[model samples]
Target chain A: MSLSISYDSSFDGFLSVVFETYRQRLDVGDIVPERPYDSDVTPSVDLFMQPFHVETNADSASRLRRAVVNMAGEDVLNLLETAFRSEERGVEMKILAYLRVLFSKSDPGFARNPTSSEMLPLFLLARAVRHEAGGMLGMVRFNKAPDGSYIAEIEPKYDILEMIVGHFRGRFPNGRWAIVDVKRCYGAFYDGRHTEILDLPDTDTLSRSIAEKAPPDEFTRMWKSYYDTMAIKERLNPRLLRRCLPVRYWKHLHERQQNLAGPASRPTA
Target chain B: MNLQEKLNILGDAAKYDVSCSSSGSSRGAPKGGLGSGCSAGICHTWSADGRCISLLKVLFSNACKYDCAYCINRRSNDIPRATFTPRELIDLTLEFYRRNYIEGLFLSSAVVGSPDATMEKLVYVAKELRTVHRFGGYIHLKAIPGASPRLLYEAGLYADRSSVNVEIPSDRQLQYLAPEKNYESIFRPMNFLAERKLEYSAGKRSRYTPKFLPAGQSTQMIVGASGESDLQILRLSAGFYHQQRMKRVYFSGYIPVNADKRLPALTTKPPLLREHRLYQADWLMRFYHFGHEEILDESNPNLDPDLDPKAMWALRHPEFFPIDLQTADYEMILRVPGIGVKSAQLIVSGRRFCKIRLEQLKKMGVVLKRAKYFIFNPDVPANLRRLYPEMLRPLLIARPKPAQLDFFSQLQAPSLPAPAQLSIAV
Candidate 1:
């Protein structure tokens, strides 16, 4: 039977779809991520198959999570979670193909085998997710909020806001810090002890005035001064500067705002 | 001067140091702390010169008592100088660290009064960060070469890493450039910290045992300052790796900061290309299981200006060419010019599932432009670039303008020294 499995686009919701597909032993040709909110980019849907909407069941998701963790191991679970976090288009179908391999015990460790054809697409997606997460761990810059807390805004290509907050919690355990995604208008906040996700509405200036942000505060001025005098004029290589801190991330970083990242200073005798 | 002006002066004075690593140690934030350590280093931002701003690198003071010809902060130079109090430095580090501006502090300095006096201030700032504030971030202290062993030990108790810069490659060259400093002063603290680190690691994991230099030590050698060949540089680096267990060896391309009679001309550009080649040779030694002697010998005393060290080594030895990708082990596979650590691991693991093909190699991120010549596979059609190693060199090397690439043109180097093992008390 050519059945199209529709999920609510949440990690648990997608896992329940996997649980239901196995319970009924139905052959799923495609997986569609159904979102309650409007998205301009229409998701992939297999037109030939009858659509099967699976309601998100927490018990079913938990059972499958335990099963995958128990069978394939924790690292493999992380790989699958990264697939969900990646939010790559058509990733649901790739995950469906991956789960089919996982359910069949012919190659019990197929999830770990990145070179295999079945796991390659998921692996590539997971790799992009991980790379951005690592970059965010360093690329995130914080400015002090008026209420004596740290706040920053980022616009990453992937859904990585949740993936990076754990690092901040570890680095700033006693301080309150919040990193918001301006595109989604959502933030992951650390409140000295626990972390929470909340909708942030006051990030309009972040997207609007990012490039025009001058050094208004003393600390920003110090950082800008430090960054300016740090580079040796004789060894300026723009190619390497772009490679380390990419052009896509320049909007948020205050120092990279102006066109002073390249070789500007002449060698003073 | 105010804090901003002081930061600019001290930061500018400390800019020449190229070692920005914050790796090889991991510590979590303390109970009421401001920062934590990550073993995999994170670069907060890159400067205009493409250098990683991993640390808030600054000097305690640029006021010096000794005049080293290559140093910007030397006493002879009349550049604007400033110093930061321990309280000011501590606050700056904590605030910058709390705001995620940097990983930690890289506090180096010129001698204010004496080595002991300067080392005491650096140690005091680090101790306050560790004990009073519970700052768990990566702290890299400069183990002042001539500082007392007790001070170095005290600094190590609170620091994740410490380094003593051997500014010149050979000891004789160092004496000529910076006559106030000697080989004994440079190596004494290094050898002391290395031995103490060994004791901490080898001893029992007792509760009282403090974590001492968890990231160990590293050093930097200026590339173009002295007339030493690439051969000498690689040998010193290899000894540091093998004997002292150094984590990293950085090469600064000797930007002509101060112009003394002994130093390069003020207008002379830094030897960036030679610095790049030396880094490649260093990588071959550290990661590719290559010994320093095997990289550059007495016959070829200098690294080739055109080709990378690995490619040059491959072309020199014809027997090692045309390595069968399917049959070659991991070490030999890594020797192939374009195959990196990641691609080699992929080839080793990927071939188990299917017979490796040309397209699969490209998918695994192998740069077949160079690797195709060295790899022996049925899918790879043989060409002149592969058949003749000499023909391959011209194709691989993109010849930049003659004047731009020739940093050695100004060398007027002294004649080569004997190739007996470098025994200058490294």
Candidate 2:
């Protein structure tokens, strides 16, 4: 009989499900995150299997980690981590399928064969997340807070706040900064001493706080002036500009924000 | 003039330079420093022309003694001129860095009195940034062609990368365009820096030896400005790569800035296609293991503008066709039209356990539409076998569409957003 496995939405939680799948030898019909209505499912002939809740524990997670490392190489762990971070539906199932292929072999080289059906989509998803993270490394524009901290907000398609925090910490050592993943409702913040991830409040409260601590008008004005003066008039190709810096990214960019002010009213600073 | 006006004049003057890379250095933030450099470059923004604005690319001064025909900052050009005080430039750089608007500075300049004087000022700025500010960000300085060796070395110590532009490929054309400049002045600094880099690297075991141009040196060659053949240009570039160990060779399609009688007519559009093809051929030489002669020989001194260099090479050498996917070596697999570096690596790894089919190749990022003609895979359709290389040539050539005939077509129909095409990996 098929079993519907459910767990908390996290890497360790997913690992716990994998651990239970092997321990019980259950035929997993579907692996999903725990939902409120999971207990209220009406029994049917086609869906006769009971839902199984796999509690996430360190021991079980570590066992699955060891199994993955032994079956596949160490690199597959990174692929799994990056792929698991993606916000795509059925990504957990895909990871489970890929791991199953790896665990089945005595000497599985799934990492080597990136073109395989089971691994290709996972790699692509991981690449997309990485590409977005890389773009954010450049696109993250920080506004100076009144209290000497730097504040920035981003709504990345994937959960990349954790991936990009180290870069900012390295680039701005000793400087207090907070990078909020607006869509994810959490932020990675770095105080002068240490870095931490915190759950953020709503957008209205965040924007109000950001405005209160925003840098002086002169800095933004100077940046806009610099951006406007950089482009050559004769070689103006907006198509190419849009290609390099996509329109979606322009909303948060300092230069693009002030572009609507027109050249006449630009501040001299 | 005010700072904004000065920026306007200087930024416009420096826009024609195609090199905007802020890569190749991995300098960490020093104790009490402002920034750090990541080995992989970060492009902060792109200009209207689609070029990356990685650094605060600007000229220290637009006051030139020599009159180059193609340069906007030439002595005879009637344009607004400005020069930034060293303190002002330093302040600007630091402010921009704090605000996260730029990666670093790509400081180039026009001849101010003499090459030695010009170079000294540039080196002084770099040295001050390194010593006083303790800045760890990427700095690309222009190595003045006729500067003293000591200044060049000092500049290298402070800068991540240095370059001396060989404006015209051929010496004759350079002399014809700018009488004051010559090949020796440009090559002298390049050869000196190249040797110094080698010397520094040889004693790299010692921690005391300071890094000299850790990003290495690069040079720019203006295409279509001179009457030099692609063969000559590629030959010179190969020599630079082999002998001088140059990091990059940039090709800027000559943009008409002034109405010089000696230059190609002012109305003539820049040779964008030729420049693009040269970049492709350059990529072949650097990454794809193709030699200079293999890319462009005496028979074809120029790259075919219609087809990419790899496809053109495939068309010319029909003898090496239908490469078996399962048996061919990694190098041979890389030669296929549709297979890129990533896909070729995948092919080699995937073939160890099982024979790779065409569908698997497509999944691995191979452009099967183009590779179908060149590769012999297990799942390749039987109908594709009837067609020959000659029949595929016309099909492969990317023809301009009927809608593209309109002058304002690009304006009306926006092109899909994509990454910068010219940022080459070293």
Overall lDDT per candidate, in order of appearance: 0.84, 0.82
Q: Give me candidate 1's interface root-mean-square deviation.
A: 1.4
Per-candidate interface C-alpha RMSD?
A: 1.4, 1.8
**DockQ of each candidate, alpha-carbon based:** 0.58, 0.54
Q: Which number leads on TM-score? A: 2
For model 2 the TM-score comes to 0.90
- Cα displacement (angstroms), candidate 2, residue B17, comes to 0.9
Native contacts retained by model 1, as a fraction? 0.75
Query: Mind giving the per-residue lDDT tens digits that candidate 2 earns over B1-426?
Result: 888778778888888888988888887787887788888999998866777888988899999999988888999988989999999898888877876788889999999998999999999999889889988888999998888998998998999999999889988889899898999988999999999999888843755568989999899999987789988999999988898899889998888889999898888788878988899889888888989988889988988888888988888887887889899988888888889888888788778867788777777779887888888766787777546667878988877776546668668776854445434431
Q: Estimate each model's TM-score.
A: 0.89, 0.90
Candidate 1, residues B16-52, lDDT tens digits: the string is 9988988888888887776888999888999888989
Residue pairs in collision within model 1 = none
Index of the highest-DockQ prediction: 1
> Least accurate stretch of 10 residues (summed lDDT) in model 2 chain B?
B417-426
